[model samples]
Target: MERLVDYLAPRGPLDWVLKTALFIAAINGLNLTVEFAMNGALSMSLLAHVQTTSMVAFPFTLFALSIIRHQHRLQGQLKHLATTDMLTGLPNRRELLRRLGEERRSFGAFILLDIDHFKRINDRHGHAVGDTCLVRCAAHLSGSVGPGDVVARYGGEEFAVLARTRDPAALEALTTRLCEPFTCTVAVEGLTVPMTLSAGVVRADADLGYAELLRDADAALYHAKDTGRNRAVFAPGRPAA
Candidate 1:
């Protein structure tokens, strides 16, 4: 089957060539074994026969590798499309949730941020300008987070940051950094647009599931939106059972 061939195919260029050579050698050995069994003697013609057959098979081997490589590249692109936001090129909500579930047992902080008056921007400047703002916002958040942390486009005008750390000071530092004013402005159609973010921060307990983590963070985000537009609000920690 095509799937089986793809699964067995080597991923790297050198590996594929090496495997192809080995495969041809294997087939040649089998043919020689069968020939010697019946002919009762090996002839010098065997060497010439192998050289001729290998030369004949080389083109087919290259063609097959080309197909396999194309399929692999396509599969990789599909995976990226599934997990990434097309406009922002950041991880999407689905990918963030997947990571949250995986890190449920680890103590961390979950922060949800929304662009303040994002609809106003869309209405006033059109969706194209709004999209440009979103792209710039994503770039800023992506650059702000630590290497181990994840920043994702949670949905339209909203983003999520998952920081894997137990220290409260570290969490506070991150929230403070996010709450600080964005240093850059989006330039679209010769117009400068300023952006501000409102965020909800929640401590992730080891025993807490991702569902609860999301819920707590959402509630905090609501608090931030309700209290003021450009601020971060911390959700109260879950009481010990």
Candidate 2:
């Protein structure tokens, strides 16, 4: 019974279509059965009625299929929303942490990036402009990073990137690539403004926990923001607090 219920529960558009086809076939078969019982012979009138009913039911079957297809598409979209940042279209903090745990055994680097003086932008131009700046920064980071790299929105004005790589030079190059100047036109009170970012990079080893790597990367990020804006800091031997 459980298996039958599972089979009946809508799996997807194909499942719904198959079920609808079977339902229509069953209805036609029942109609034929009743006709044969009453008339003792197959009649052209009953066959024609069944054909007409099938023709009419075809559109209803397609409509059911369309609804199921739409529902599955919406489910996919909801899953994406749960895992991704709405503003930057990057992975959300939850996903970033999840990936970090998944890749802890492998050789990789964890980078924490934050927009420098982001609050200042909000104070001067307003929150709307600040949001625009974040979105633009996200686009640049997404483009600058490599295919295997994972970029995520860690929080407000903060982002995290994870990449599987062993070479320190390659990691350094990635940090440099992210720090390059990016200009975003943010409309504030009918005027446009620009903003920049600062980042911190830390390589993760087999011995380090994912949380520790995040802490180290965050420290480096704070260091960058403190010394100056729009720079990258690499934490090679820093211990997590």
Candidate 3:
């Protein structure tokens, strides 16, 4: 009984319509079988009845197509939700890695950026202001990237950018361009604070692979922090061809 109820349960208006249409089709088929058994042939009146019954089919077809379209739209929404970070509205780690794998063959650059003194911001002004600061920085970073470039929140206060280019000179110039905009400060929740970030860059290449690229970028980020805040550093290695 429970299984029967589950089978009959309506998912939505379209679902109800589809189920009702199928039931009607089944009933019509059964009636036609009974008539054929009694008369050994379908009379003209019975044929007309079947044709009249099939009039419902046009609407049922439209309903079924609409249900399929709605399902596809729902799947797309689910995919987007799974790939997006809610806090900063940037791509989440999973999405970032997916893009990285897709763009692996194409020589590109990965930049790891962290807000300078992020913990200090959270400690001084509390977590609310820290959240605001993160959102602001993410917005800035997203706006700075070129079309087809990716900016993702890599958990905590760190974000990563995937810039599609191989040339060290071009990547370096793009990195510099990205870094230049954060010179301004953010005003959030009655607190005015500088949005300083230290960035580490690694050029994706055939030799190093992605994990090493991430490690190198992280090391360079720490180097930038150790030397001076609010600067960008590139991992030192064989230049990509």
Candidate 4:
């Protein structure tokens, strides 16, 4: 299911095809042998030819099946790699956007968050520590949001969350946890280092397109950053107080 490109045909039947074809071929060969024997037309030469054909057909069929299985597994692995963030093990931006596009009905909110002064952390602690910080943040965000929500790494120093909840208080609480010092933290060279998050959120609507909502969310996030970091701003309406 990872890819639509079926190497063998109208999709989802490669195994069935292999099994059915082998069964039918076997039945036909047996019928031909029985008929020849009954008619006294069976010859050693004909029997040998049938045996040789069976030997070639069986191995080739098995080989074909093995190749298909290998290719299918490889395709799945490749798809997973392409869509997932390696460090965080979360969906990457592409997957997030894909979901956004596929979702026709409105979800409650689209939230975008950025680490406050992330570059400073990187410059001071080193890239490895910075990476650790991101990993920890990814874990915290995904865990805090729960299974109902989609939390993803939205590229460097940023993460995205999509949820279908109408409660503003819940969104506010989620944002507060994200921005709270030590909530999303990492151990950098034996010292615990905490990071603050700034977020932009937009209420989803049936009227709005995915890109439009995302742009609004991005704007709201910058509003949070501009007014002061470590807060969530609701776009084009008012910053969440």
Residue-by-residue lDDT tens digits, candidate 4, 1-241: 4343354422347655766476448755885788688986754576675676666677666666566667777787888999999999999999999987886354678889999999988999889988898998887787678447889899999999987676778777776776676534454377577678898988875477777898888999999989988888888747776
- Candidate 4 scores a C-alpha RMSD against the true structure in Å of 5.6
Model 4: runs farther than 4 Å from truth? 1-56, 104-106, 183-188
- Tell me the spans in candidate 3 whose CA falls farther than 4 Å from its real position: 1-54, 181-188, 237-241
Specify the highest-TM-score model's number: 1
Task: Give all candidates' CA lDDT scores.
Answer: 0.80, 0.77, 0.77, 0.78
Question: RMSDs, each prediction?
Answer: 3.9, 6.2, 6.8, 5.6
Question: Order the candidates by lDDT, highest first — what do you get?
Answer: 1, 4, 2, 3
On residues 31-132, what C-alpha lDDT tens digit does candidate 1 reach at each position?
789878999776768779799778877778777767877877777788899999999999999998888887655538889999999899999988888998
Cα TM-score of candidate 2: 0.69
Candidate 4 worst ten-residue window by lDDT: 2-11
Clashes of each: 0, 0, 0, 0
Which is the leading candidate under lDDT? 1
The local distance difference test score of model 4 is: 0.78
Tens-place lDDT per residue, model 2, 1-241, is 3344434446767777688888678768887788789988876776687788799877886676566556666666877989999988899998888878876656488888887778888898778777888888889889988878888899998988887776877877888788887777744456555566788778775477767787888888888887776788877533222
Task: Tell me which residue pairs clash in candidate 1.
Answer: none
Candidate no. 4 TM-score: 0.77
Model 3: number of backbone collisions: 0
* Model 3 Cα lDDT, one tens digit per residue, 1-241: 3345445555688886787677667767976898789998877687686776677665765565456556656666888899999999899999998988777666487898888888988898788888888888888888888777889999899999998877777787777666664533445355577777778888777477768887998888888788776778878632222
